[model samples]
Target: MSVTDILRLGPVMPVLVIDAVEHAVPLARALVAGGVRVLEVTLRTPVAFDAVRAIRAAVPDAVVGVGTLTRPDDVAAARAAGAAFGVSPGAYPALLAAAAQAGLPLLPGTMTPSDVMTVRAAGYTACKLFPAAQAGGVGMLKAMHGPFPDQLFCPTGGIDAASAPGFLALPNVACVGGSWLAPKALVQAGDWPAITALAQAASALRA
Candidate 1:
């Protein structure tokens, strides 16, 4: 499916940092129960691939993806682990080309108009606004929309429930990625119920 379709599948896409592979299944199950279907398993830990595999194998309906992708190998690695998509912190020509060649629906990160231009030139109309707050937040997104209203973005970083709504309310925003629902301590402690509740609350925070 397209990136926009995946974003529209749910209001909140949990950006997970899986340190333990064993927690993948339960965590995915909880998010699904709370009405979330798309998840981004960031490649930040040694067991990241294992967690992706576990989530894919155990949760039949979860639309699992990978995040923190920096290199071409990162896209390949995530694909091998069964990720449906891959998210990068920033955009690069080789990396974007590799992702398209690897058949990974990539949401490349961008922090400026030029970055967006490059990604758009590569046939990607959707992107992620990394460090959303520091990059000037909704105002930045609005500025971008003036020139490229067709482009869709999922702003990540420094985005909590409070600021998320403003981004989502924008016409150019497809969705918003955040860590508010899957706190590190909660995930590490195996507190799926709390995470599910958090996801529910976030889902309700629609634009």
Candidate 2:
């Protein structure tokens, strides 16, 4: 699916940083049960690829993806792991070029108008507004709408359940990415029910 379509899958996409590969299936199933199907498995852990592969194998309803991608090979690796899409923390020339040629639908990050324009020039209409809170949160998105009216965004970083609605309310935002739904403590404790409740609330957010 396209990046936009992936973002449109739900109101909130859980930004997962799974430490254990075994938690992948149960975690994905919990999130899906709570009505959030778009799951981003960040490549920040050693088991990330295995987590993605396991989730893809076990959770057919969840659209599993790779995040924190920074290299050309990462794209291929994620695709090989059965990731349906990919997300990068920031867009670099080489990484952007690689993603374009890698056949993986990517949501590259943008922190300014220039970054957005550059990615747009590379044929990306959708992007992630990384470090969104530090970058001015809703205000930045409002200003960006003036010049990049057609561009859509999925705001990530420094966002929680309390502030997600504000970002989602922006016209340019397709959705928001958050990690609050699947906290490390809860995941470590194997509290799938608690995680599911968080996912349910986040999924009910209005965009």
Point to the candidate with the largest TM-score. Answer: 2
- Alpha-carbon runs more than 4 Å astray in model 1: none
lDDT of 1: 0.90
lDDT of 2 by residue, 1-207 (tens): 899999999989999999999999999999999999999999999999999999988889999999999888999898899899999988988888887787899999999999999899999999999989988899999999999999999999999999999998888999999899999999999999999999889988973
What does candidate 1 score on TM? Answer: 0.97
After TM-score superposition, what is the CA distance of residue 106 in candidate 1 from its true location, in Å?
A: 0.4
Error of 2 at 7 (Å): 0.3
Model 2 regions lying over 4 Å from their true place:
none
User: Mind giving the per-residue lDDT tens digits that candidate 1 earns over 104-131?
Assistant: 9999999999999999999999999998
Among all windows of ten consecutive residues in candidate 1, which has the lowest summed lDDT? Answer: 198-207
Winner by lDDT: 2
lDDT of each: 0.90, 0.93
